[model samples]
Target chain A: MSALLQLTGVTAFYGAIQALKGVDLVVNKGEIVTLIGSNGAGKSTLMMTICGNPRARNGQIVYDGEDITRLPTFEIMRRGLAQSPEGRRIFPRMSVHENLLMGAYGRPPAEASQDMEQVFTLFPRLKERMAQRGGTLSGGEQQMLAIGRALMSRPRLLLLDEPSLGLAPLVVKLIFGAIRELNRTTGLTVLLVEQNAFQALRLAHRGYVLVNGAITMAGPGAELLARPEIRAAYLEGAH
Target chain B: MVRDAGLSALVALGLFSSMIGVRMTQGDDGMTLTGRGGALAAVVAAVFVGRLIMLAWRARRPAGTPSPKRVDAGLSRIGRYVAPVFLIAAIALPLYGGRYFLDTGILVLTYIMLGWGLSIVVGLAGLLDLGYVAFYAVGAYSYALLSTTYHLGFWTTLPIAGVLAAIWGIILGFPVLRLRGDYLAIVTLAFGEIIRVVLLNWTSLTGGPNGITDIPRPTLFGLKFNASGDADTFATYFGLDYSVTQRFVFLYYVILGLALLTNWVSLRLRRLPLGRAWEALREDEIACRALGINVTITKLTAFAIGAMFGGFAGAFFATRQAFISPESFNFAESAMVLAIVVLGGMGSQLGVALAALVMIGGSELFRDFAEYRMLIFGIGLVVMMVVRPRGLVSGRTPSIFLGKRKDIAADLVAQGRG
Candidate 1:
């Protein structure tokens, strides 16, 4: 499959300290590519850089035949990219339905409602808590709402940052299962960042291991999962 | 708990000693403690005793147990009827009430308009604008200058002034597009000062400190509210004897209509996508951008629309006074309007109107208090903040709801994150 997103020599910084150092990565169309890393490993930094928040100090980020290296975050989102950011930053004051509607802020109303139905189908709990305040939701439900909100944008490339963080084993399984199902059925391209290395690698088609602001390994997900060094470093005792 | 009460007593002592201990008299022996010292000590002792009682009460409650929920059914049930009843009373006031009450009503309505205008920026959009009075100034000056130079009527100048202020809002909005919270507040405050300084310096255009005078009052169609004018006066046209109260009553109704319009438009806009965008931006701006909302456009619209309303109020103020000056639009005016929004509870239209009534009417009632008016007002504000830190009406109903509409408690909503 042709590449849906390609980042070359991407360098990013926060103040004087560098967060990403010439990181190279690619996500092919109709594939789930996971980036596995520990905390403080520049995974979120790369995600934010791709969205042009603290933009890449150097390098090229091409998405769907267009250079999006310097596009503003909202502009990047308007170009069919969406991120379910870390910490599930749902608008606390907004109801669950309003938060979902916000995800379709840039789309036509009719199509947005259609996407909303798809999201509701994926997370029925969200439908049950439709009128509840976002802040009042439980941790698992809030994560589902965050994912549902991102899905409402109908993004061509969905970038998820630590989707399974702090979730129960069953909820994590459900989230990862949904991600895999989304890719399989709709050919939705996903670039997932996860601390749960074993589960992420199992779900993705290809995987990249990032350490200390640089990629240490890249290969097919099965090959990386089988590596003795990767097992010792990341997958030790992980379910 | 004993130590806490002692600390509170000490603090109260310091506060009361400086603020209420001594009085300056007109006699040769100017400074006199008199009986005020005893009163101050009594007040301090009362506060200390109150704190001790509160501490004792808290100690009696078991730890780690949730407080019992207070039933809010009666209050909300009453709230459903409050608005219609208030509207009827306001409409009937001129028929029975005398001239003084009508004047106070006009004053209260003006503040309500200003409070609503500021609410869009501070409450909905989460942009802290301490320079809102700048837009008010722009509107007043636009009306003052346009009417004086071109002899435009109040009705004609009203919209032009609003547009002019909106343009200024855009102008101010552009430079501070990236600032948020405290930084945004400081910049807006400076912008307000800049406008006032310009008005003070631009002597020829704004008439300097002397201000523009003899500006025409608003008319009812072609009829003026005066004894002698070229066209038929309001009194003559209606075939009633001329009374000064007629003008005051008319002005009161005009302001009441404007305030009601502000409330209606604000409520309508809250349900629209743009208004939802404002609340979303207020909640978390980065998430708004992630959701493909143009933050700059949202911020600009909030500022411009808010300023437009401020301009309308300013124009009305100019016509009401029949004169305009820089003194009317100042930082204190901005603070007062901002206070109304906060005290009313952010993003609640009814809260703003209630706050404006209590704050403005309370100040008006304390007019006879003279030098002590501001002191009493300060104490009232402090007590309000202590009693209800989130303002009087802390519950917020979400604009869009799927099942049944419910008011979200104030603490449930994010606080001042922007």
Candidate 2:
């Protein structure tokens, strides 16, 4: 598989403190890539860096054969990268419909409705709460709406940061299943950041283990799942 | 109930003792202090009676018959019909009311327009702008300068003034792009003061504090609303008797048209994509960026559009007064306009008009009670904040809805920090 997004020696910082320490990662076209780490290991920082916010202080980020290391967040997003950010950053006052419309902001209106339909197909609960304010949605429903909103952009590379972060096991299973199904059916490229390492490894085609802002392990999902350290460190007490 | 009333009267006595009981009057000998026992007793008695009536009213009402939320909802529901009815009364005012009433109408409409203009920035876009008067000054000065320097007519200078103010909005927008909440307000407040100071100090161009006078009034397609005897005069052209009230009536309608246009455009803009982008920006800036919206452009547009309307109102003011000065566009004007927006409930256009009517028109009625007007206004605002923190029309009708239209209660909506 050809690499859709390639990051080399990527480092990011908040003032003097470094969040990403010379990390190298690759997300191939039509492949589900998972980045697993414990809290504060720069999993989210990595995702945000690729989106050009707090940007890569030193390194190269090539997305779809174009350098986007210094591009503005909105510009990078316009280049077919959509992020369902951590904590589900939905517009609380806006309706579900308006939130979806915002995701499809720069796209053609005619195509947006069709894209929205595809998102609704993935998460039907969103359609029921279409007129409801985004803030009023339950945690799981908000997660669904966040993913649905990201899908409205018809992005080539879907970057989901901790989709199952606070959800119940069943809802987590449902969300993971949707991501896996979407990848298989549409060949949609995904770079998922997760603290739920076991579920993530089981769902992803390949996985990277991050510890202390550096990748400690990289291999196929099943191969990583079988590693003793991976099982002990991430999956020991996690269901 | 008697206990509550007694407690209220006691508190009232403590509050009003020095204010009502004691007075200082300039007599032939000098300033003299005197006691007004009767006045103090009357005030205390009035407070006692007021508390008793309030307690009785509350006791008589059934429990939860009208929740605050229900009241807010009902008010907004009635607010729907209030607009057209108010418009009819406003349009018909010149027919029945004398010059005093018409003049008050003009003042009220001016504020209504200003309130609606600032609402776009503070309400929809969620940017707290404290220097809105900068644009107003820019507009007024633009018209005054053009009319005096280039002999441009009011009709010709109006759009020019608006464009100039919008440009100033953009100018102010660029520097404060990253500032939010209190920081943004401070910078905007500084910007307003800077504009006023410039107008005050620029002796050569702006005539300094002396101000520019003889700004011409608006004419109806080159026909002047002046005394009859000349063919170009409106009275002569129409073959009607000339009356000074005719000019006042014409100015009244001019501002009415301008204010209504401001309302119409603002209403239409709310339904557009640009408008939605603004509200989204207000709701969450980070989310807006993640959604690929150019935050810079959105913020600039809100400022520009809001400033444009302020500019329109300013130009109308200059033409109506036939004079322009920095004093007219001061911090107080900005505060008054912002207060109207807040009191009207942010983002609700009709709420703004009602607020302006009460604030400006009500203030005019209280002209005789100048000393107490501001005190009463302050108390009214405090009461409003405690009773209805979200203003009169707190619920928002979603610009776009699916299945059926529903008003999002104030609790669900996020009021941006601004």
Query: Highest TM-score among the candidates is held by which one?
Result: 1
Tens digits of per-residue lDDT for model 2 on B1-418? Answer: 9999999999999999999899999999999999999999999999999889877877886654433767877887898899899999999999999999999999999999999999999999999999999999999999999999999999999999999999999999999999999999999999999999999999999999989999988999888988846999889999999998989999999999999999988888888878999999999998888888899999999999999999999999999888888899889999999999998888999889988998999989999999999988998898777556887677777887544323322222333211
- Each model's lDDT comes to 0.88, 0.91
Which window of 10 residues has the lowest lDDT sum in candidate 1 chain A?
Answer: A120-129
Off-target runs (Cα >4 Å) in candidate 2 are B1-67, B402-418
Model 1 interface DockQ: 0.52
Candidate 1 chain B: minimum summed lDDT over ten consecutive residues — where? B409-418
Candidate 2 per-residue C-alpha lDDT over A136-170 given as tens digits, one digit per residue, 9 for 90 to 100: 99999899988988988999999999999789999
TM-score of each: 0.92, 0.91
Per-residue C-alpha lDDT of model 1 across residues A1-239, encoded as one tens digit per residue: 79989999999999999999899999999999999988899999999899998899999999998999988888999999988998889999899989999999867889988998899778766776778899999888899899999999999999999999899999899889888889989999999999999999999999999998999999999999999999998989987
